[model samples]
Target: MMSSPPAASPQALLRRLLSGVARVFVVPVSADGQLLLHRHESDRHCYWTYPTMQRGTMRTDPATVARRLLREELGAESGVLRLVHVLPAARTHARSAVYAASLDLPAAEILAAREATGTSRRALQGLAVTAETLVALDVRPLAINDLMTTGGIPARTLLALPDLADPASTVNQPG
Candidate 1:
């Protein structure tokens, strides 16, 4: 068998890889200002995340990755994916680009592969969470201009959503 490259070769390559863009975060935003997220826990308290996917190769385009994720993970065929911004992630210690897509309507079934994301389409299976409910996650303040630019959404959207400030309020809702 042929010998593999030196261990230092892999290490050096990783350094170069991490130095640049490493992952893509796809955010689906509804016209009413809600966002698509995933969860694993079925209880009142659960962690959430965007449908994030890794770049297969450095030369791969971010939009391609985002589209692939929507098609593969959620089985969404059509949507206009827009490049939003590149942001740093303290949790992963890597920089990631964020892409947003406008949703005409909610999908009948979301999160096609629960095994992939570790979320069970639980009680609040609705990935389309409102602005008020989003901020409650504490990942970042969704009410701020950042994170899908919540500040730019119409006031009527918020008025249309139920009072989900209380996590328990969603307990009775479907996943």
Candidate 2:
């Protein structure tokens, strides 16, 4: 008997490889509240994304995972972070947490955070581009762009729609 060939697109396969890998999107804002972004080569479809979170080890705890990801991805230190939303397993593989955070650290402070978390190598490759720059690059506007273009729901929650919003919470609760 002949077996059926595997059914998955190349993009789907790559996504599957990255599946179960919890990630975070840090909507880093300037003191003036402008969003900060950077060029991301892996998702070459676009050239930018929010200061994002990537998996560190294999942990899944939201806050811990987020903290670890931030340090690893952004070289950020222990600072206040706000959870904008949590998207649970949208495409059968990974869950993503979207967050907004602020950092007023100086060069020395940022360097310290990098050294403390051993994340210098990653930071060197990323740049602190403002939202405007992202738009200029047409970075596919994952969330905010969707919102602006679609004029419906906020793009952030929309892209991950159906899975958007924390599954466990019914009301706003303090973290």
Best by TM-score: 1
- Model 2: lDDT to the true structure: 0.48
Can you tell me which runs of candidate 1 are displaced by over 4 Å?
Answer: 1-19, 30-34, 42-44, 109-124, 138-145, 149-175
Instruction: Give residue 127's error in model 1 in angstroms.
Output: 4.2
lDDT of 2 by residue, 1-109 (tens): 9999989775565344445547765554333333445545553363655555556565554456656655666566434555555546654224666655544554455
lDDT of 2 at 25: 58
Distance (Å) between predicted and true CA of 86, model 2? 2.8
Mark the regions of model 2 whose C-alpha exceeds 4 Å error after superposition: 1-21, 30-36, 40-46, 53-59, 88-93, 106-118, 123-134, 144-175
Worst ten in a row by lDDT for model 2:
156-165
Best by lDDT: 1
- C-alpha RMSD for every candidate: 14.5, 11.1
Residue-pair clashes, model 2 = 1
